[model samples]
Target chain A: MSPPESAPSIQDKLILLVEDNPDDETLTLRALSKNGIRHRIEVVRDGVEALDFLFARGAHATRVGWGMPTVTLLDLKLPRVNGLEVLRQIRADARTRNLPVVVLTSSREDEDLIQSYGLGANSYIRKPVDFVQFMDAVRQVGNYWLILNEEPPGHVP
Target chain B: MSASLIVPLALSASLVVAGLSWWNVVLHRRLRAGRDREEARCSAGPSPEEEQWRRAALEAAGQADQLRLQLRETQRELASLSYSISHDMRAPLRGIDGFSQALAEDYGDCLDATAHDYLRRVRAGATQLNLLIEDLLSLSRIVRAPYRPEEVDLSALVAAAAGELSAAEPMRQLHWDVQSGVAALGDRALLDVALRHLLVNAWKFTAGRIAARISFRVLETPGPEWPPGVPVYEVRDNGVGFDMQYAGKLFGAFQKMHVPEDFPGGRGIGLATVQRIVARHGGSVRADATPQEGAAFTFSLTSAPAGGEPPGAEVALPAGRMPVPGPGMTVPRHPTNAR
Candidate 1:
């Protein structure tokens, strides 16, 4: 008896992956490629870059009016700002309040899970070490969030 | 005239004595009332026998405090060791698994049949090592981490695990029945792991069977599986059962029973983790099975905290970490060949 979800209006498929570890970054890229996600995948090494990219500040101020990525895969442990703080900043901002943030990390601690969901994360995905399973997880993420899930409001101009 | 003077003096003396005695009575009554009020405010006035027990309890408590400190130190050490193993060992495994796959993909035609088989085996070994490291870390973590006690919907947890098992292998014809409203007071995340392990074991042992009937039912009646009035849970499966004589070895670390040859993908640490979780809750689990007649695991949750206190209306209380054999455990050099 509920209303149907709003369909996505943006044609560009941009995925912003915030990860610091080089090995994991490589593995994630491989998994994303294996899943055939040929979207404009922009990888940021730490939380600082992630915030800058999202908010159009610091180094990324050149693209001030650019639209936000469809899905932001946020990693918890980063060099400068860390993932939880980035998530808090994202939730605090009015422009990116409804942005779909999926926490992708290796930590299975209950503390991290509670904190991620507490910060209004849309989903939390624990990265499995096995290559095959990791690939499958990436595929599911792409299929659901990128392909099926509705975009947040205030995107179309 | 001298007699009259003596009489007045005697009356004065009597008056003085009477006033002093009256004040003494009032003071005595006040003292008795104060003592009685203090007694009423306390939980209970210990009897002579209870007082003696309290002295002995104090001595025992002093000894227990020392043991608790020792246990905490050991837990800290295990946490560090687990970190080293996870970071130090797993990094190489990723390299091996990743590069080998790249090798196989990039240059498959240049390699001979033997070379191809050798690379395949290398990748498989690295994958197996990854699984083993994962199992070791989980085992260490279950013991090292603090407990969280709360009301857990056990039936729903088992159903979820069953759904995952079936989803993992969508082709299998698996029938799992979980009784409704089966609940317990314990850590939710921990109890889920224990339940998942039991279910996974049943699912794994029954791999080749055409008909796999797994049931998770609670014993409503007061039976011997639990105390006179307590209920216990039973996980029954018509899977490949082992001899009862080997049951003693089932809950050991890196157990040789579940080699890659006999079973496809198991490190034999799942049951051990279940045992650790049960022990943390001050509960006990037992297994019985006949070869090919099926196996059943029955567990009763006493759910005592690390302090061994009876569970009251406590919610999500973090228990002190109890020490278990961690870095001291010996993992086989080649787990697949160890069996």
Candidate 2:
């Protein structure tokens, strides 16, 4: 099926997308383009890479003078470090503790929601099955977290 | 003449004693013969056929013992596996949910709404996985926890439960009628879980009603055959009740009277958990309801002694008195309202 229609006027914001699937990553990028949110997007395959990107550790260590992203969109399932552990780590560290974290997943379980909130997730939303609906959710999340909500200054690594 | 009579009496007595001794001897001989026969049969030693029978019996006993051990081991293994699966599966699901959330926050605007939605779906799916794990853990806990029975104030528990419910759904116009002074002997925790499930069910079912009326009270009936007084706790609610035909399966795991889509949420394990908790506490639960009118759940604690007289017949609450509230439905007086 053809992708949804594009939105006018792309917003300029830096975003780091942590996703394992290449197709999903591409779809996410395409959706963002359609929404006119043409911010610089950095993609990571898993939680470990996402952490490295956030902390400027491992391979990202060479990239000096990098600042924390405005928000962290976390997926619960990951290859190395799981989302909850990542959140715990983020919350534990004073530098990234106040960083806005949202949990996006397909799970409708109460425990997951409770845990997300318990671990200090800013918001939790379930992904829609339909492609168009999915796009709407993405747009709303982007509009709400990026343009609407005010976030703290970047954490220095 | 006297000496002759005495001599005859003594001879007769001797004769009688001799006869008795002779009979006793004969009886001893017969007993010895019977004992010999039994001993001979026992000591004859097993023939080939007898030996085979004896060996088969021993083997059957050994096999039975082995089977019993294997069954026990299997049960233990199953319990452990379920526990591990519930515990270990959460970490990965958390990772999926967390990272997707992170992705949305950081790059949501860069991506179109569709991509953001997909990520949200992934996160929701992970969250559902986590809930399934939790439900399994709850079921396991109900089975594994030790049960200790004690006197539980049903009135106080019911009042507290009602207060909590009111606090939760303050918007709803709820009428709670909980009797006072109801008490029973049961495991407090298990009973609490069961009662909570019932109250929660009541709350959910009555959601559509403009005015919800929930009652926690004890119904005293004559015990069958044994005693006059039997106390049964009843939790009644004016809500959307279920069909009578499906009532038998209401307590089965994952059994739902309504579709998941309609309910929007729930693992359908609440009633099953309640049933398990009740069974563990040696109690019985049954639901009675019509489609739209309401539902009443009644359960009895097995550990309670049968009342000697009809409830309220013997206790005689003072003039104009009434029975106490059921467990977990009490309403605490507001601090300012205290006398």
- DockQ top scorer: 1
How close is each model in CA RMSD to the real structure? 21.9, 24.7
Off by over 4 Å in 1: A1-12, A153-157, B1-54, B65-95, B144-250, B281-339
> Interface RMSDs of all predictions?
2.9, 9.7
Off by over 4 Å in 2: A1-157, B1-75, B102-110, B222-230, B259-264, B303-339
- Kindly list the per-residue Cα lDDT of model 1 for residues B170-233, writing each as its tens digit: 9999888889899887778889999999999999888888888899998767355465544578
Could you tell me the fnat of model 1?
0.14
| lDDT of the candidates, in the order given | 0.69, 0.63
List DockQ for all candidates. Answer: 0.15, 0.03
The candidate maximizing lDDT is 1
